[model samples]
Target: MRQRSSAEHRDLCALAPELSESLVAWWEVHGRKDPALKPWMFRADGRWPAPEEALDPYGIWIAEVMLQQTQLAVVLPYWRRWMEVLPTVEALAAASLDQVRLQWQGLGYYSRARRLHDAAQTLETQRWPRSLEGWTALPGIGRTTAASILSSVFNDPLPILDGNVKRVLARLKAHPRPPARDDALFWSWSEALLDPLRPRDFNQALMDLGATVCTPRQPSCTLCPWRLHCVAYAAGDPNRWPVTDASKPLPFQVIGVGVVVNAAGEVLIDQRLEEGLLGGMWEFPGGKQEVGEAIEATIARELREELAIEVQVGEQLIALDHAYSHKKLRFVVHLCRWIAGEPKPLASQQVCWVKPQSLSDYPFPAANARMIAALIDHLRADTLSQLS
Candidate 1:
């Protein structure tokens, strides 16, 4: 681990009293009132309607995975729709990859859906994992996610070191370094401060406090339950507690994206292999732009390499700039005419030709979705023009 400064060391070394009463009290007043916010529980008040139905392991697991990089407000509708469509582990396991991806459309991280599906298959056969080790052994469930599930369902005294908890604890400790830099120390503090008696409420309260009060910007210190206990607040700038080095400029890549349309007015899309980024999601066939290569040349070469076919690059459809976590991408999309051999799934999972209007039935990454929209609009305009 990287060395922490003297100030950082002092912030992390002290132990706070494990008093969660005030936090829990604050939660009762200001925590998320929606029952769906905590997926296992059926009621917003945290009261169990019935022991059997109160805790849906399947629902909680799905929610946890979706909630990984997404905010609660954004995931609510998606969660509700997902539950309505595929409520049980058996249902999820039985779902087709395309079906799962379609349901998870616009969720941003497609790999989570793929892993969730794989884990669901395992759980459907053997049943929900009882222990943290058992849960973490499954796909996509990490220490924090497993802890969240266990504590929420079984009231296990496991500590969660999620982003929210990290922020709250970092501020409380006045840690002058990012929590990610010293996770071991943060985990230790989390474990020490966890309320063993009411672990569920305690964990939820801390999460709520971080999200609602101890936010990344303009934190509501006056309303925070642990305001007095927060060392960063004492220092007078709570937002600056979890300090990070200046961010480096993200690298940019120019990519050639092709929207190949056939005479039947159907678009060709390929299923990505079930690994790496955007795995199992469908995308317009294209590749990275080689140095000094023209965008059209890059598209043709990529198509030949990927699908063993040839395409005549036609009108430029759109040029979109999208950013991933580490890099920026400039996708120069074009309306391509399929000229030679039949496109094959040589490098992808599968290749398909589908009507442009029915693209929603399949799942595409956010950038691909933009390409689809632009194609649809262009087709509509052409149709109106021909009619006129």
Candidate 2:
């Protein structure tokens, strides 16, 4: 752990008690209490439970994992749907990976779902972890996630350093560098400030403070509980703290997608290999377009190479851009007529031909989901024309 100056540590210690008290008091009134938004935190009466009441650890685990790199509003529906289906560890362990992926369809980070499934299976054979080390041992349960779950469930007094807490801490102390640079220092600060008796509420308050008041942009310092003691607020530039590293432009690639339809009117889709990006998800046959290759030609070539089938690429179905965390992709999709060779999974897990409407039965990446909608619309239009 990176050590801060002795004077800095002394100052942090001096204000830790008051900071925790003020934040927790503020949170009781302003913290997220909506039953619809936080079903895990409320009772049947749609009110917060008594402080001594226990929360569902399983639900807390699921929400924390889903909240990683995803916002709360977007995660609410998915979390509710997931809980409806696989409400317990045993249910999740028993569910197939395909079913799990289906539940996590629109969630961009597919690996998190996979890891949760794996962890659940592991837990099915053993007891739920009670300690920080025990929880961290589970797949995809990092220190912060493990701590958050433990503190929320067991009141373990384990401080969290999630994105929200990091920003809050960085601004509170007027950090000179990006919070990512000295994780140890931030963790130390978080630990020092944690309210041991009210670890659960204190941690929740810290995250809420950052998300609502000490926000990354245009923070409402006047509304902040710690504004009087916050270093950055005193400096008159809260946003200027938590300095960010320069970002590089994401590399862009043009993908050529072939929506090959057989004479029987079934479209070809394949499951990606259970490795690498978007693993285990189904997608239309496609590959990156090489330099100087016409998009149509690229589509035909990709179909041949990927599925071991030839196709006559035709009119464009849709052209859409999708950005992932690391890179950006522009998918150029086109309608195609299958020409030769039996469709085989040459570079994928498997290939199958299904009615366009049946495409919904499979789990696809977000971009491919858009393509399916377009394809379905196109097919519906064509059917109406023929009927007329």
Candidate 3:
């Protein structure tokens, strides 16, 4: 753990209490009259029907789970897929662990996906449990996950203690109190302080406000509803507040392999089997890069290692940028013409050459999608240039 500077400590330390005051008032003014926003809600202006069926429980669950260490923008696609595949507890409960894994293939944190599967199965078999406690008993249904589910599905106003919300509150209170990574302390603060009457709306507002206006990098203080009450903003060092810095030195690696092919215009792709790092997905042949080796050489080496085939590295295509939960990746795709040797799966699981027309038959890793598109584009352009 990196040590926080004294000034940074001061900024973060006051975030919590400050946040509590500000958000409370903000909620009082802007809070919805939806019980779905709170525990057992009320109706001031007949707003009860508004939160009926949040229609986004699955998206909310997937978002919270995928957001473990990932960014908001990056989680969108994965969330959309999860939504389409398993929109509700009932749908998710019916899904197999393997199917869930496939749907959540690129979302990282495989355990969350697995837990969701188990929880879904449990949800299906067991009776519809009402309280958050009952929901929490299911696998992967943490306090935040349960809150999101209840708020989105049942519109129960349970305080959602997500990271963005924690950061917002921590900064608002100028809290020097260290936020436990597992979110225990934050959960306590959130639940206790949350006005159960509008837990759902308040939590969602906090999350949205934090992600958008009360941002980590550059907060839009002028537009914030809680601007008047924010102590962190008053401290003139909002960014330093919630001094949570578990920075990891990004590990760099290289992948070298060809979009292998046969004379029939079929491309050979391998379904990655490695667990925990973009597992169970197909990719155009390649693996990690070595020091001091040119990308072309690395490509040849990777082909020999993974596919056991010799290839003449041709021209270099565009570079594809990709980032997983744990590491960053830069894939330098190359145009390669086959040299020799029959295709044999050595490092990868199964290897096959499906025609370009039938490329959609296999499931490739999300990172490889760009590379595959680039590969096809490169081929098309080369053919056009030749014809010209």
Candidate 4:
């Protein structure tokens, strides 16, 4: 929305030419050579066979979604697996939620996977988004994501301001305060420095520069191509350029997880609603530890409340710690024997009794997954002892 003649635009105009030229040239040599960005867009000869070929929008959209709040290194394998499994938007749309969740089991943010499926269905009804506005209108696609997709796939000359780009721009300007305070300035600066001729390569180069060189910790300024143009480097403190806000203590919760198993060795699991954190995933039926209640009592209460059934809470199975983005969790997993009544989905979307061996087919959160591992190990050892 910012015009090139604006005052903020004028401030960056003088540096824009040199910045874009130098940055793109540097990218030619140091830019990430990974095909993760758009593997389908390249050829075996290392050059684009069809330079004008429209990129696979589905792949671009998937990569952008996976990359949100996640590092590229962590996303690479998941991206590869996803592409192999759900190569087309229509395939993703047709895939069951359970299958999608299984593929995204360890990806931390389960909501992204949900939105990806939702958006894939939406794309089937409509068409693959060709413009930034169209892309952002889809679920989970924000301005940065939309811009990245549009630029890389459509060569739309759109500017992106992801975490990496924000850090790079903030340091380039030597912003003494958090860039979030003046988002307009950072966005405008990113636009001013965008190279329209090669938007895809230019944006990728900028992201790589920030991720590899202008890191959050000690930046490799000496090897950086933009060191001479960086206001932060000139000020002798690149790390201080993007001013950091005071950190807040993350609140912690004590959870009680029940590994309820029947005589048939089937475990009780519940499906979370498709809304909040870890939505649409199956988990061992349990809840937060209530105040003044013992861990065992908490498990009994959670089972009674969550499922319309009573249980006898047994010994502790596993005690593990997990940290989410906003809260830390201390999960005290307990073995349990199902008793009294039949289990039903009282507070969850659904409930099921699955065999221990088939638990891998259902998607569970990281914390619940750990509990499953412990349960499997205990069951395997018990079987061995009986055989011996």
Candidate 5:
């Protein structure tokens, strides 16, 4: 790993000349074939796709918001469905909150959905943002996001520092650690360094090159347009260019969720606190795991702490594995029988013993969704033959 040094940044402005021609020429020949680098105007097979003329300002704005922390493949269907439902800002403004949130399920990052719903109001009759600053003023539009919308949607020359650009610049600049602390410098360099002759295409090309050719791991620098000018490739470790400190270990949060079943065979569940990690969602009761504590003990302590009822923690019902953006976690749910104390909602907003069939009506975290689905399927097996 290359150590952080002042020499890395020494007047790179002069040594690394702006190679707009290098990038544009590369895009002309090899770029059209690449899906990642294919701009809105062009398709991979050299077909011209006229999205701008077909898409209005409001549609483009909505597309930008949904793209955050979400993959292109995943966002496509949702985008189409959303556009059909709310063709204009006024349509989204008039729709109910629950209407949008339900379709937004599985995308994660609830706040983005909330803000996009809110921002639709401001953008409703206003002209499209002519500059980066204007785009940035919109709700949920951060610096990079604003830059991306301006450059991609409006065809402006604004630079983008999204995950794609971050990956590319990490290798180009060759730093190590999460780049948040150095973002200001990165943004300034991005905005200033591009060859202005083709700012829109150049910025988009860089991001495209970063995503496909100069990827996060095992970047195909040989196929990269910027490879000829990239200092990281010359340094013999192109993969190591975007440098950052090693990742902090994923914190383990162990908690026991209650699967309370009564004589009616209804399983008890609770609506999670609507403001924290799983706000406005439903999950079983649980808390963080203490170091060196047994699962049973942890469950007992969490029950007393969160639900205020004593319970006999039973066998493990099932284990669901899930990975979040920042951490990997396992949700181990257990079968429990409440022995004493009246059933009450202490930590949750509401509590209910939902029938096994009715579980599908409530929204659960992606991780919890697996266990809930499996349990419902298992319960339906016996009744299937009788119904038929």
Candidate 6:
């Protein structure tokens, strides 16, 4: 653990109580309290429940998991829909993986959904974990997530070190190093500042302060409750405190995607292997465009290699770009006519033939979803022209 000076430690201890109190007071007035949007935060009387009053653990778990790498506004509808559909751990565990993935469509980071389902299944067989170790034992539940869920649902005094809180802490102390470099220090800081009596509200208020006021860029320092004490604010550059590592350019790859249609007017799709990026999700069969290969050849080659089927690559249907956190992809989609051989999942977990309309039943990556929409429109136009 990186060590701070004795004087700095003393200063932090001295400020902890006042800091927690001020933030909690600000939170009482400005914390997220929308009953309709976040029903778990309120009681039947539509008031913020007391700290000792435990909220729905399942709801808190789902919300925290969804909020991982996703913003609050983006997660709101998804969280609401998930709660309505699954409602309980039993429902989520009993539901098919396909159903779970469908609910998580367009949410990105499909792994979170899969892990949530797995954890739900585990929870169905057991009881809700009360300790940090038990929660972290589950798939996808990291220290921060477990702490957030525990604090929110049980009013545990555990602290969270999420992205928002990290930024807040970094600015508060004007820490010169990136938070990632010394996360232990940040964790300690979070613990020191946490209000043991009302952790639920205190943690939420801290997150709200970061999300709304102490933002990543162009923070509203004037409105921030902690501005008076923020070291970064005193330095006249709050944004500079959370020093970031130099970023490497995201590698870009050109992918040739094949939309294979047979004489029966069914399109061939495949389920990716149940691991790695976009794992267990359905997508059009394709592969990276190799050096010195034509886009159409790439499509034909990928289909042959991945699905063990031959295809006559036809006119381009669409070409689109999609970016992940670590990579960028240009998917050059072409309509293909299934030429020969029974399709087999040589690289994927499974392959299926279905009408384009049925494609909606399967969860596809966002880029592939767009391709499906285009394929449907194209097919619809073809049918209309034939009828005319």
lDDT of each: 0.84, 0.89, 0.68, 0.84, 0.68, 0.90
Give the TM-score of each candidate: 0.91, 0.96, 0.75, 0.93, 0.79, 0.96
Ordered list by TM-score, greatest first = 6, 2, 4, 1, 5, 3
Q: Using TM-score, give the best candidate's number.
A: 6
lDDT tens readout by residue for model 6, 1-388: 2356345556777899999999989877877767765676666677777877877788889988889999888899998898899999999999999999999999999999999999988999998999999999999999999998898888899999999999988888888788899877788889989999999888889888988888888999998788788889999878786989999999999999999999999999999999999999999999999999999999998898888899999999999999999999999999999999999999999999998888999999899989998898898899999999
Q: What is the overall TM-score of model 5 with all chains considered together?
A: 0.79
The numbered model that scores best in lDDT is 6
232-328: candidate 2 lDDT, tens digit per residue? 9999878797889988999999999999999899999999998899989999999999999999999988888878888898999999999999999
lDDT accuracy of residue 326 in candidate 4: 93
lDDT of 3 by residue, 317-379 (tens): 667777765677888877677778888878666778777656655555666667777777877
Candidate 3 lDDT for residue 307: 79
Candidate 1 lDDT over 342-374, as tens digits, reads 989988999999998888988899999899889
Which regions in candidate 4 have their CA more than 4 angstroms from the true location?
1-9, 36-53
Candidate 1 vs candidate 2: the TM-score winner is 2
In model 2, where is the ten-residue run with the lowest total lDDT?
1-10
Candidate 6: where are CA atoms >4 Å away?
1-7
Worst 10 residues of 3 by lDDT: 33-42
Candidate 1 segments whose C-alpha is farther than 4 A from its true place: 1-19, 36-39, 43-54
Q: 1-388, model 5: which lDDT tens digit per residue?
A: 2324345445445544445566667766655333332223334355533323222456557767877877666777777677787777788877765566655767787666667778877777687777778878877898877876666555666767887777676677666556666786677557656656555567656765765688778988888766766778888888776676778977655555667666578777777765656566667777667789877777777777766778788777787767766777767777777766655778888777788777776766677677787676655764796788
TM-score of 1: 0.91
For candidate 4, lDDT tens digit of each residue in 255-367? 99899989898889999988888998999988899789999999999888889788899989999999998999999999999987888888889999999999999999888
Give the better candidate number (2 or 4) by lDDT: 2
